[model samples]
Target: MKSYEYIEEVKRANGLDTDYKVAKLLGCGQNKITQYRAGQTMDNETARQIAEILDIPVWQIIADMESERQKDPSKKKAWKMLAKLSKQAGAATYNLLILNSIISFLVIYYAL
Candidate 1:
């Protein structure tokens, strides 16, 4: 997702009414948030924090942000690929967790 989209999601999820509140949560100034909204690439640290807040893979966020920051076509392509792979990995992890929970529930039910 784009940086602005991430900020919008954060604001919606956290009930943040303004960029200032989101900035406080992100440990940055409101202008930084504005910059991001204005199409600036978010820094790595900010990406990490956003990942934590959004409960997504840090690598995914990092890759996405890096993709935006990269000027070279090859570098941008690589970052985009990394972001795609990380997103798939995250989905796989989540599916595994769900499967594990189902298996555990079945085992417990059978034992009882």
Candidate 2:
């Protein structure tokens, strides 16, 4: 299931016509939808945006087709890496926010 197939499945499931509605939901131009439907390749950013709009797991949609092309062991490793990366990235972002807040507090205290 390529991203395009995944998208079409979503549209059919939702009973939507034309890629315009999908584009609106995804905050992209209608042409992007057309390109996807036409089987033109899209970058990861665009694929992520579409996944966000459709409320689907980005990896699930993007990896479905690619995973089928890989050996079972390799595909499993890829999934594990994806999960680990997502978790680590989220934690790193939260840590950054905490650090920023501490720095801000220190700055304010010194100023006072």
Candidate 3:
């Protein structure tokens, strides 16, 4: 899909039918909706919120961004690498934190 259409596709992927519904959920307005649908860039918070709405990992959001804007070779390559690294590191870090917490809990329980 093209840059302008990725959001719509993700929206459909998430079972959301329209930008209005997303806007309501996002607490934004039609202009902001237009920006999203127009494929304008957004910050990380907005990206994460959109990912939440799209029910995809944030890396997928970064991929969507990279996929849409492939004209700039350097930027695209950089973001692609960043996204790939972020996917690996982010998931590993998250899982490790969870595992560490569980291990800590188990240790405390056993000690008690």
lDDT of 2: 0.66
| lDDT of candidate 3 at residue 104, scale 0 to 100 | 100
How does model 2 score by TM-score? 0.47
User: By TM-score, how accurate is candidate 3?
Assistant: 0.60
Q: Candidate 1 — what's its lDDT?
A: 0.93
Q: Write the per-residue lDDT of candidate 1 for residues 1-112, one digit (tens) a residue.
A: 7899999989998999999999999999999999999999898899989888988899998898889988999999999999999989988999999999999999999999
Each prediction's RMSD to truth: 1.2, 7.0, 4.3
TM-score to true structure, per model: 0.92, 0.47, 0.60
The digit string of per-residue lDDT tens for model 3 on 1-112 reads 2333645655676677887776676677867768865767655566677667654467756675764567888878777777677667767877898999999999999999
Report the candidate with higher TM-score, 1 versus 3: 1
Query: Which lDDT value does model 1 have at 13?
Result: 87
Q: Given candidate 1, what's the lDDT at residue 9?
A: 88
Give me the runs in candidate 1 sitting further than 4 Å from their true place: none
Report the number of the highest-lDDT candidate. 1
**Candidate 2 displacement at residue 1 in angstroms:** 1.0
| lDDT measured at residue 64 in model 1 versus the true structure, 0 to 100 | 89
